[model samples]
Structure formats: structure tokens, C-alpha cells
Target: MGVSIVDVAAQANVSTATVSRALRGLPRVSESTRAKVLATAQSLGYVASPSASGLASGRTRTVGVLVPFLDRWYFGHVIEGMDQVLRDNGYNLLLFSLGGYRHGKMRRFTESMVRKQIDALVVLTLGLSAEELRQLHRTDIPLLSVGGPVEGCSGVYIDDGAAATAAVEHLIALGHRRIGYLRAGIQDEKNFEVPALRTIAFETALAKAGLELRPAWCMVGDFTVAEGQRAAARIFDAPGEQPTAIFSGSDEMALGLIFEAQRRGIRIPAQLSVVGIDDHEFSASAGLTTVGQKPLEHGKTAAGMLLAELGGTPHSLRETLMPFELMVRDTTAPPPR
Candidate 1:
């Protein structure tokens, strides 16, 4: 027979209520008592069944994570961090992926989620509309967001404006006057505005540096390697002025530019310079200079905040800015003589 909560409570010399409270991380249990109960439970190999625990503590022991695209590098790593923290804290994960088509899926998921399946929710870089936010609020679940700021949602993310400005300033400092930009083109700026923030900052930095944005060289890469390569091709194949440096919105896109540049025998930093945001896993190996921020850390922090709120301790629901840095690498230098 499996060790039950009754046995654990009996051994710990506490009521089953206390045992449940401690196990569920509910308040009112003293720290010493909670530790004692946990130790006793561990000694007896008492593993609380999720169903039974939910019935006892009014918790589902699960967290729901909503993401726009599961295949993207940022979302995947952030989910990994959230999953690690959730599983370690004796919780299950439920993933809701839009696959980039949120028009229908967003509404449907919001409706279905109010069924009380999860104790809390973590949204990844998805812009929630006012109506959608209201639908989510109807669930009354603790909510947190990762990637960018969302209305009515506390967010954990790097400052897109700062990160982009840094990238542009780095290129400007390298004396690259003829610099172009590879931007992310999300169709709905009203929903997901992180790309727009980066775009504004990119242009702002260039303008502040007294450089004009060359329309011929600026193109949208959609924050993916394949699309980035295509945009790079357009920039190179286009008529008129070619940029000596290009600032890509993401490392994935920047990598594509490098691949395309090399294929065309364009010597990096000599004939063309490249800089990007997001120190993607391949950045170092690929020698990408970028504004680096850890998506995994964003995931873990957001999940931790939601879990704390679920455990009867709520954190500030304001924007939590994660750290970022300029990763200078081999891909950038002064313009060719």
C-alpha cells in the first residue's frame, strides 16, 4: 500500500489538514512545522496524488502555458525553464500553442481555459487583446507573461527598446554609416508589439546618430532563419545603394544573413557587418554579435511568480525586466575601406 497523507500526518504528529497545507505551500503553517512535515513525508515516501491533493487543497497542481509558436527558439527554451520549475515543485504543465494563427485559437483557448483546469497561467510573448484579456481574467487564475508587456498582465522580459538601441549603437560606434535593418514583421502590431518597439528603437538610434534609414536595404525577416536569408537576398540583389552593415532583429535572422553572405562570398565585417538581438544557442559558434538575453530565465521567473501566487503568496504584477548585455563577437567591425 502507498504511503498516504493520513500516515504522513500521523507520523508527523499533525493533523491531515496541516500536512496538506504544508505540502501545498499554503500560508499559516509555520516554517519549522512545514519543514518537519516535508521531511516526515519524504521519509515515509509519501507522494500526494494530484487528484486527492486537488480535492483536499482546492488546487489542480497544474500550470497552463500559452505560446504563439512552439517551434520558435525563444518559446521553447522559456517553456523548458517553466517546466523545470513546475515539475520540481510537484506541478504538471499544460501547453496551449496557437501555431501562429491566434485569431480563432486565442478565443477558443480562452473559453476552454476557464474550466479551472490549471491553477495558474504563463503566457509567452503573445499580445492579448482587451476582450481576450477579459476572457482570461474570468478564469480568476494567477497570470504572468514572458517576452513583452501585455495589458493587465505582469510581464518578465528584457526591454526591447534598450536591446535594439544597443544593437544599433554598437554598429554606429563601429563607424558603419551605411547600415540597413532586417526587421521582424508581425502582421498584428495591436496584439504583439515587441517587434514594433524594436523597430522604433532601431530607427530612433539611427536617426539620433544622424544616419538615414535606407529603404532599399531595409527588409522584413519575420524573425526566422529562412525568412532572414530571403530578406538578405532581397537586400543584396536589389538595385541602388547597398548597406555596409545590417542590424537584424533576431539572432536567427542574423544567422541567415551570415549564411547567405558567405554563400555569396561576402567577407564578414570586411565587405558586410551584421549585428542582432537574442544570443541564440548558435550565436557563439556562428560568431554572431548581438544583444543577449536569456529566454530561459524569463520563463523560470514568470513561472515562479505564478507558482508563488498559486501557493497563496502573490508577487508584484508589474513588468519585471530581465537582464541583457551586448555580446561583441566576430561579426561586426568598421565599414570596409
Candidate 2:
């Protein structure tokens, strides 16, 4: 024998509607009445059924988060931040990890799978094509993005190009003229153009300083430690002048460069200064200098935006650019005379 709203209302000498509103924490119920209803419900061991409540209110109080890669540091950090914010506001998270091959998953998520599950959607580090976005828009799901720009959606993102420029500027300020860049060879199937933006920023900054943009000084590598290690070996062994500074697109790659460089007795920040983007956890532990983009903040903000829309609040549809900071550390210094 379970207590229902009727039992709570009768015990509190209140209407069933008042008991229901009090249990849901809606504003119309006075505090005194709410307390009475809560006390009655607790004494009778009455609990509100989320399934029944959802059927009545037409809201599940859940948010769906779609991320392209789960193993990467940036995506992981963002998810952690989003989880905290959503939980605090009485919303549950439904996470879907799109595999490394993101193209196929992206199409399916927007079309058949995610439409009915969540009240809102949060996408991370992924660029949905125009057509795909249009199809998602048709679902009328409140959408928010993190990590990159998305047209016709509210989002929070860091300027990847500016962050890249800041990393290069730090090395330049240290008087390292010959800088080598380790970057992704091409965009993956997610259609995210992060690598392209980094490349353009690197070249733009170098050109402004009257430095020659040498193709040889640039090496193509994926966002993996192994790829960075391989690229480091090729750069150090190539028949040309060794660069005094190395700017890696990611902290993972930068760590690989430092490891390989140390094994060969190459003194860090003396013979070679190294700088990386995304101040990941390992960056601090390794004392590696980096350009910091707050992925956690980005995720929290994106979740907040989606929640606002779900709450029937007015949410602006535009790119939200989060700021970046330069974290100076032991890895970067002036090249030796």
C-alpha cells in the first residue's frame, strides 16, 4: 500500500493540486503549505513517479549530450563540467559518444535516435553540416554547441585561431625565430575545422613578423602521442636547420615531443623551447607551458544555455566565444645564445 498525492493532500488538509505543485517545487505553493505537504508525504512514504509526472508535464528533465570523441582530454573535461551543472539543476544527462569516425554517427543522432529522449541537446567539438543542422532544427530540440562555431544555434566556444596565435606569440617573445609546428594533416569526418584554423593562425602570425612560412618547418601529425613522436623524429632527422622552438597543436603531442627530445639528450627550453595549446592536466604535472582554453567552462556554459531554452526562457542563437589565457611554465624560454 503506497501513499499517493491524495493521501498527502488529505493528511496536510490541502488540495491534491497543492500537494503536486509543492512536490514539484513549483513557485505558486506557499512555503508553509509546501512544508506541510512535504511533511505529510514523508510520513506516508509517498514518492512522485517521474514517468507519471513526465506524461502529465510533457518534460523528462533530461538533456542529451553528443560528443565526437570521448578519450580526448578536451572532450572529457567538457563533459565533466556539464555533468556537474546539469545535476545541480535537477536535470539528468544522456550521453552518446560518437566514435572517431563521426560522420555516420552524426547523421543518425540528429535523425532517428535522439529526437525523443532528451528535452535539449548539447554537441561538443563537432561541426554539423548545414543540411544536418537544418534537419536537427526541424526536431525543435533546444540545441547548444561547445568547442566550435555552429550557425543558428546557441553555443560556447574558444577561438582556436587566437589560442594558436597566442602560443606562437609566446615562443616569438622568447626570441625563437625558427619554430616548427606539429599539426593535424587533415580534418576528420566530423567536419570540424580546428586544425585548419590553427594552421591559418600560425601562418598569419609569422607573416606579420616578416618571417618566412616554410613548408619544411611544418609537419603533419594527428592528435595522438604516437603521431607526435613520429613527427618529432622526422623533424629532428631532416636535412635542414633544426628549429629552436616547437609549437604543437595539442598538449598530448607536445608531451610526446618532449619525451623523444629528452631521450636524445636535447636540452629543453635551452636548445629548444616547446609550447602547446590546451592546458590539459598533464601539462601542469609535466610543467609544460601552454595556451589555456577552459573546456570545463565551455561545457558548463553550453549546458546552461540548453537548460535555459528548455525552461522556456529566451536563448540567443549565436556563437559564444570563451576567452583564453597564456599559462607560462618551465617548457618555454629564450633559445640559447
Candidate 3:
């Protein structure tokens, strides 16, 4: 027979109730006691069944994480941080991929979520519909968002508009008057606030710097290397004067643009300059200049907030903006004379 809670409680020198509370990560359990109980449980090979525990405490000890795309670097890193935190707290994570911004998929996911047993919900980079929001609100569970702000909910994210402005300002300061913007064009227009804010900030920065917004300089890509290559080719093949510098919405696209430019016999930082958001892992090696925010930190913060709420200390439903830095690399320089 498997080791039971009684064995763990006896080993930890605590009551069965206390052992249960500690194992479930409930509040009021001292850290030392919790650690001792966990150690004892581990040593005894004791594993509490989820169904039994949920029946006793009315909590599943699980959190549901909703993401747009699991393949993206940002989402993957954020999930890693969140999963670590959840495991540390003796909780489990249930991941639900919405398969991009498809309305039908979102509806189906929301409907399915209503049947699942979860203590909290975390949404990454995707906005919820009004009906879905109402459904989740009715559950009265802690809900957290990452990478973008949601109405009437608490979230952790960087200021997309400010970051975009800073990136464009860096190019402007380097004496680049003609600048291009490469933006992600996928996702439903209504739910795409992050890119919209960045686009607005880019235009605002250009206008504030007394530079005309050239229609030919704005290109839309699918936030992929191939799309970036295509955008770069279009800019180069155009009949008019090309922009001296380009700002991509993501580092992957920026790297792709650079690779494509090199393939066409164009020199980087000598004939063209590039800037992007998201300091992707390969961005450093590729020497792509970008505005960087810590996705892992965002995940940790969101998880902390949810745990706090679960522990009966609900935070205000205000959005928290994380910090960002402008990373100067070899790809960005002053416009060629």
C-alpha cells in the first residue's frame, strides 16, 4: 500500500490536518513547517490524490494557462517561469492553446474551461471576449494576464507603446529621418492591442521628430523570418528611395530582414539599420538591436499575483507595467551619408 497522510503527519510531528494544509499550499502554514512536511512526505513516498484533496478543500490545486501560440519564444519562456512557480507552490498547470486568434477556437476553449476544475486562470498575450470574460468572472477565481492589459482584470506586462517609442527615438537620435516599420499583421484586429499600441507609438515618434510618415515605409509581416524576408525584399525592390532604417515589431523578424538583406548583397549598418522589440535568444548572437523585456519575470509576477489572491490577499484590478531596456547592438547605426 502507498504511504498515507497519517504516515507523513507522524514523520513530520504534525497533525493530519496541518499536513493536509501544508501539502495543499494553503495560507497560515509556516514555511518551516511546510518544508518539513513536504520533506517527510517525499521521504515516505506519499502522494495526495487530486480528487480526494479537491473534495476536502474545494480547490483543485491547479491553474489554467491560456496562450495564443506555444511555439513562440516569448510564450514558451513565460510558461517556463510560471510552471516553475506553480510547482514550487505544490500546484499544477493546465495549458490551453487557442490556436492563434480564432474566434471559434476561443469560444470552444472558454466553453471547455467552464467544466474544468481550476483554482485560477492566467491568459498570455490574448484578449478575452466579453462573453468569455463574463463567464470567467462568474467563477470568482483569480485571473491574471501577461504581455497585455485586460479591462477589469489585473495583469503584468511591459508598456508596448513606450518601448516602441524608445526604439524609434534611438533611430532618430542616430540621425535617421527616413524610417520603416515592420509590424505583425496576423491576429484578429479587435484583439490585437499590443501591436496596435506599438504602431501608434512608432507613428507618433516619427511625427514628433518632424519626419513625414511615408506610406511605402510601413510593411506588415506575419511575425516570422520568412515574412521579414518578404518585407525586406519589397522595401528594396520598391521604385523610390528606401528608408535608411527599419523598426520590426519582433526580433525574429528583424533577424530575418537582416539575413535577407545580406543575401541581396546589401551591407548592414552601412546601407541599412534595423531595430526590433523582444531580445530573442538569437538576437544577441545576430547582433540585432532591440528593446528587451523579461518574459520570465512577467510570468513570475503574474503567478505571484494569482497566488496572493488565492491566499485571500486580492490586489487591485490595475495593470502593472514591467520594465524594459534598449539594447544597442551592431545592427543599428547612423544613416549612411
Candidate 4:
């Protein structure tokens, strides 16, 4: 038989309850006692079973992470940050990807999640409906959100409106009057509040600058390189005067547009200036101007908040807006005379 908590407690000269508290890092346990228990447990190869711990204390020692797409760069980076914190705290992660399926995925997932014993839940960028939110609330678990805000829940995310406005303002400052706005098209039922907010910010910034937002200049493309290339093609093929600059909603799209423009023999920054958001890994190497937000930091902050709540620490349920910076690289310059 494997070494057990009883062995650890006996070796540490403490009661089993004391051993359990020390292993769980509970506050009532003294520092010396905790250290002694940990050392004794380690020496005996004692590994506490999560199920046994959950039976003793109502916590599962596991966190459930719900994300729209695990393959995407933003979600992947955020998850990495959360995973680090959870691992350091001796907790496990249960990932639920809500990407596929035609319908009923969110409903089924939320309903089934209530039966699972997770200490907390972390939602990343997937909007929940009123019924779904109500169901989650019924679970009475510590909840956190990243990448966008959820009503009645604490979250950490960047101000999508401000970031997009900053990108647009940078182009306007460079004397580009006819600027195009390339945004992601609404593809699914998921609440894409980020793109919607960014679009509003783009229009508002243009209005503030006393510049007309041409109907033809507003293009919708999926947040991807291929979509950006296709949108560029459409913009250039139109009969009206082409925009001297373009503000894309994502770095991937911006890079795609730049590649397509170069293929068409259009000089970047000289003939067609471009800007994008996200400051993706390739943004710096490709010399793309963009508004950069830290996805990894957002993840860590959200996870910390959830952990605090779970640990009985006082925390506010308000939305935490992260910071963003404008990276002016070789892609932007003063409009041609």
C-alpha cells in the first residue's frame, strides 16, 4: 500500500487533522507545523488525494477554465498564466473548450458543470446569456472573467474601445484623412462585445477628428490573415478613392493586409500605411504598428482574483481594466503629399 496521510501525521508528531490543515495551507496551522508536515509527507512519498481532501473540506482543489478557443494566441497565453498560478497553489485545472457544435453547447456545458465539483470557474471572452449566467450563479462558486466583462462577476480585461481609438488616433495624427477600418465580422452567437466596442470607438474617434467615415472604408473581415487579405482585395477593388491608411482590428489581419499589399506592388507606409491591435508576436518582427495589450498579465490577474475569493479573502466584484500601449513601428508615417 502507498504511504498515506496517517503516516505523514505520525512522522510529523501531529494529528491527522493538523496534517490535513497544513497540507492544504489553511491559516490555523502554524508555520512550523506546516513546514514539518510538508517535509514529513515528502520524505514518506505521501501524496494527498484530491477526492479525500474534497470530502474533508468542501473544496475540490480544482479550477474550471472555460474558453472559446484554446488554439487562438490570446486565449492560449491567458491560460498559460492561469495554469502557472493554479499549479503553484497545488491546484489542478479543468479546461472546457466551448468552440464546436451548432447549438446547445453553452447550455449543455453550463448545466452539466453544476454537477462537477470545481472550486472556481474562469471564463475567457465567451459571453454568457442571462439564463446561462443565472445557472452559473446557482453553482455558488468563485467566478472570474478575462478578455471581456461579465455582468455581476469580477473580470480583468483591456478597454477595447480605448485601445482601438488609440490606434485610430495614431493614424489621424500622421495626417491620414481617408483611413479605412477593418474589423472582425460577427460569425457566431457568442457575444463578440470586444469587436463591437472597438468598432464604435473607431467611428467615434473619426467623428471627433471631424473626418467623415466613408461607407466604403468600413470593411468586415474575420480576425485572421486570410480574411485580412480578402478584405484588402475588396477595399482596393472598389471604384471609390482608396484609403491612404488602414486600421485593422488585429495584428494577424494587419500582417495579412501588408503581405497582400506588398504582393500587389504597393509600398507600405509610403502608399498604404497600416495599423493593428494585439501586438502579436509577429507584429514586432514584421514592423507592424499596433496597440499592445498583455494577454498573459490579464490571465494572471483574473486567476489571482478567483484564488483570493476562493481563499475567503475580501475582494471586489468589479471589472479590472488592463493597460495598453501604442507601438509605432515602420508601418505608419505621414500621409503622402
User: In order, what lDDT does every prediction score?
Assistant: 0.83, 0.78, 0.81, 0.80
Number of clashes found in candidate 3: 0
Query: What value of lDDT does candidate 2 attain over all alpha carbons?
Result: 0.78
Tens digits of per-residue lDDT, candidate 1, 1-337, equal 8888899999999988678667765555788988888888878877665454533354667888888887899989999998899989998899887667645543444656534456677788887766778777665556788898777788899999999999999999989899998987756344577888999999999889999888888898778899999999999999887899999999999999999999999999899999999999999999899999998888888878877776666454557999999999999999988
2 against 3, candidate with superior lDDT: 3
TM-score of each: 0.82, 0.80, 0.82, 0.82
lDDT of 3 by residue, 4-46 (tens): 8889988889987678666666555678998888788877877
lDDT of 2 at 173: 86
- 1 against 4, candidate with superior TM-score: 1
Residue 18 CA error for candidate 3 (Å)? 25
lDDT of 4 by residue, 66-165 (tens): 8767667788889988888888988888887776334554334564563345667888877777887877776556678889877677788999999999
Write one digit per residue (lDDT tens) for candidate 2, span 1-337.
Answer: 7767788888899987577656654434567987888777778877666453532243567888777777888888888888899999998998877666645644444455564456677777676667667766765556777887666766788889999999999888888889899987665423676777888899898888777776776787777788888888888888878899989988888988988899899999889999999888889998899998888888788777776655545544357899999999999999888
Q: Please give the ranking of all candidate structures by lDDT, highest first, separated by commas.
A: 1, 3, 4, 2
> In terms of TM-score, which candidate is strongest?
1
Determine which window of 10 residues in candidate 4 has minimal summed lDDT: 50-59
